[model samples]
Target: MPFALYLLGLAVFAMGTSEFMLSGLIPDIASDLRVSVPAAGALTSAFAAGMIVGAPLTAALSMRWPRRRALLAFLVSFLLLHVLGAVTTSFEVLLATRFAGAVANAGFLAVAVATAAAMAPPEAKGRATSILLGGVTLACVAGVPAGAVLGTMWGWRSAFWAVALLSVPAVVAVLRSVPATPAPTGGGGGARREARALRDPRLLMLLVLAALVNGATFCTFTYLAPLATSVGGIAPGWVPGLLVLFGLGSFAGVTAAGRLADTRPRPLLAAGGVALVAGWAVLGAAAGSPVAVAVLVLTQGALSFAVGSTLVSQVLYAATQAPTLAGSFATAAFNVGAAAGPWLGGITIGAGLGYRSPVWVSASLVAAALAVAATAHVTGRGPTSPDASRLQQTLP
Candidate 1:
């Protein structure tokens, strides 16, 4: 792997930390801004909405720019947005800044995906994808908790400042490491040219699968804290440790995907999907057992991320014809899931389904994804090789 990939991963770590750490700082933000907690939580939804919109929008606008230029533009935008957010006293201004910051974050992520794939050999795409995603898992383990602590010790504004500071190194990394290749010659007509890939049923299927698989992940993940405390009988103090355990499992899962997804995407997805379904079912059944919940949390996190990362690699591979827009498609798919999962989990919880309801919801979503993967595998549409895809020929 090139050092450039690690640089991209570093950039991702900063952005990922900002994205996830907001959950911990929501109460502080609400209190400081004199808004209700629910209103404050809407900031996260705004970010997710921006992510969904920004990926395709940014990719389209920057279609003709060199990858390095595009990346720096997004990173610098992200850094500035965080600074704006930190200084803003008005809640409305902070909300808008969060959305704008997310747009920049999504833009950089979209470009990073394409850049990482471009840098790696065809046979190593999965490994490259995992390396980039490794930043996210690392953020989950360290950055988020640290940000929460920073917010608690200082103030919510400090976390925003911290994100801005983190982006400084990421900007430097891109400047020093990412190559200044010439602007892309084709796919420059805009999103219309890139949208060509959507016409392919295989690419469409993979996107849907990505959404479903990720939806399952977030459904359970979003509710893990409540489930652990209310049902598993764990102390509230142990919640952070549980989250760290989940992050550790995610790291393990992504590492495994980097090794296997390029060559054996089908088997990996199949096995992972089954494992996730079974694990969620067991967790739901054993919800009252602290030990079982802890064990399952670790295992489920591993399976969810492994399968999710593999699906991302598949989406990138399947959208080969739209090289410039491929990353945006993956980004959009994942954010769609991220948004939907929490909504669905919230719905179930509101309906008196209890905290464990998300476990069942997660299992159902994974089951649906598994069915799609099975259909793709049986119909000869899923990923099968590195140099070639079962669904279509690679771009020349």
Candidate 2:
């Protein structure tokens, strides 16, 4: 809705590019740094580690700073870290920079979600979040592939350099466009007060739902390459196109949630959950059919992101008691899912389960998420439900 939200999305695009593009650069990095591919892969794990730990910690630490100041500080830190990562010759230095850059990125994302919510009307929060997260979808669509191409043509370090260069405009735009809201009111009491918000069952349930939905998404997504090539019989060259298709579907799904999530969160989640379960089951059954897999990938991607993005907004609303830390809760929830999903998928594949096993894993997670949504809806216990106001009053 606001121009500032788009600028925040722009910044997210740069950071998200760095987050995902590393997958494409791992081989080059391992060879250049004289490390094993597995070691280079640890760079991704380091970034995920930063996201999980950094989101809440950085949000609490910066809770008393002016919003715009914290944002700019994080942005500058991200840019500098990318530059450091780009120039580093040692594998350890690059690894450290990746972790630190993720910390900065996590902080910026937490603040950006809060700031985006603050800038929009209460009713438009979902739309604002979708707008912000659109950058991530865009990164998956364009940035990751571009980085891969750059890595192939030039070097892996050039991908890092590109992230640094792209962040410059985002930094400049955020400084110029984002409003400098004063620090949140709680001051030194920030962390304690935010921790209390977690005591609400409604908030906790929403956070768990967020984790489950995203876990399903990443579980299937992380192994899409092997799934396409080995199971669907698609040529390796066509894998990138399939990824783009998934990204496009994700963008569409989030856009739909932007329109409906505020008014119809439960219904949307229920419908999306059911669709995802059926989709994943079909995908698993049809894994050998290239056409079926392609279609399912597009549809499944849409359902995953639509449900995932809705949960993000819902988590923020559920943590209304801790406005400043609401984004942090959301950040931690999704990152936890992101980290666990791929790990579970890896375990399934490593155990001699075919690639289709991850599809079943995704389906199981989505089914669990559906049950959670149904329970919340039936009992009228969801934080955004009409009775939640009365329920909040009953809580200590």
Candidate 3:
């Protein structure tokens, strides 16, 4: 991979670490900041709220700017946002800081995807995108864990300090390596292409499917630790180790997406949805057995994330126009699902159900996502089996 591409990937890695490490440090943060844990919880939700609103919104507003300037400015925004978060005094200030951080985070992803695709050889786009996204899996595998340790050692502030430090080099590298690209034109092929993409009903269906699966996954995943420790008989020491296993599975899936994303997406996406159903089923059944729970969680992470690379490609390729809009909008749809999943999971857990209750409910959610995904192919409205050589053929 080109050095520039890797830099973009590292930026993503830093963002991913900053985003995910919050979960591991929430208690420490609450204790140090003298806030209720529930209040700390709201901070995470607030950040997700920022991503939901910021992804497409930020991209749309920045459409007229040169891509390089847009990217660098956002990197600077990311640095300032986290630095503020690290130094905040009042709980409210920290919350606001994290919200800004999320906006920067989402904007970065939207731009990075476009940047990676633009940077790639037409045929190598899949690989370029995969490398970009791998930074995310890297965060999961190592960054979050490291941050967790940092938080345990020095405090939650140090974790933010770590993110601030890591991001400096990433911003510098992106500025050094990524080439200049023209501001997105308001007319020409891009406009026409965007219009065409919007005409696809399958894309809408895929969005719905994503929302459902994300809801299910987050519902279960967000509460997994408490469940495993309280009811699944897992030792407390095993939590991060088990999470590491899940991350390994997630990384493997992401790496595999580069090859599979190019060859075909509909089958892979659908298959992943089906695998999600199976994985959730395993979780619900194995909740009481530590070994079984670990195995199921690993399977869940592996199977569900296997299509990470393909999901974006499918959305982008679903229409021939406005790739930037399509890409960012797809990211928006994902945020919607993410937002809904946690809400629904919270409701389920709040209803006097044990941690295991959400597992089955989550399975049902994944099942719905799978059904919609399969329906997309059946109705000819979702991701199709892309023939890399058949671009000249008329799209249905």
Candidate 4:
């Protein structure tokens, strides 16, 4: 793999940190801004909303720009937005900055995936893509906690300042390391091409699968604190440790998936889906057992992330003409699932279903994803194309 791949991963780390660090800062932000916690929480929703709108829109607009230039622009935008977010005293200003930051984040990720795919050999595309995405998993394992600690020790603004400072190096790295590559051909009709790519059954199926898989994971994850305390009988103090276990599992899973994806992607995806379903089912039944719940949380995290790199690789494969746009769509789908999972889980809890109900809800979501994966396999379609090898050689 090229060193630039790791730099791209570094960029993603900064973005992922910005995306998740807000979770830890919300209480402080609410306290300082004199807003309700729920209102502070809406900032997260605003960021997701920006991502959902920005991904496809940015990808489409930047379709004609050089990959390296586009990436640098996005990184700079991300860095500045974090600075803006850090200095803002008004909650409304912070919210707007976060939304803009998310747009930059989405643009950066879409281009990064496309660039990685273009640079790797056909057989190693999955591994290459995973290398870039590993930063996000690493952020979950390390960055979020660190941000929370920073916020606790200093103030919420300190966390944002840290992210802004971290992003400076990422911007410099991208400008220095990433090589310029020409945009894909067919610029005049890029929008039409991307729109048509959305109509492909295989691409659509993959997007749906991506959404469901992410949704299933977040459904349980969003309520992990409550479940751990109320159902598993675990002490509040142990919850963070359990979350660390889950993050570590996710890091390991994505790493291993990158290696297996090239040789056995179908089986790998299928197994991940099955494992998620089984993990959730077991957790739902054994919710009262701390050991069982702990083990299942780790298992679910591994299975959930194991397939993430492959999902991006498949999107690139399926939408050969519109790879970046397809990738943006996948990002949007994941966000949609992320949003929906929590909403649905909240409904289940509101209806007097026990905290454990999220386990079943997540299981059903993954089960649906598994069914879609099966259908995709039966259709005998794959992401590979005759031009893939040639494109890899041409990438910077």
Note each model's CA RMSD in angstroms. 2.9, 3.6, 3.0, 3.5
Tens-digit lDDT string for candidate 3 (203-226): 777667656766776777788788
Cα lDDT of model 4 by residue, 326-361, tens digit: 668878888888888888998999999989998899
Off by over 4 Å in 2: 383-396
Off by over 4 Å in 4: 381-396
Higher-lDDT candidate of 1 and 4: 1
Each candidate's lDDT (Cα)? 0.89, 0.88, 0.76, 0.83
lDDT of model 1 at position 395: 32
> Which candidate, 3 or 4, has the higher lDDT?
4
lDDT, residue 322, candidate 4: 76
Give the TM-scores of the predictions, in the order they appear.
Answer: 0.96, 0.96, 0.93, 0.94
Would you list the clashing residue pairs of candidate 2? none
Per-prediction tally of clashes: 0, 0, 6, 0
Please, what are the lDDT tens digits per residue for candidate 1 over residues 256-356?
99988887788798889999999989999999999998898899889988998888888888787788889999999999999999999999999999999
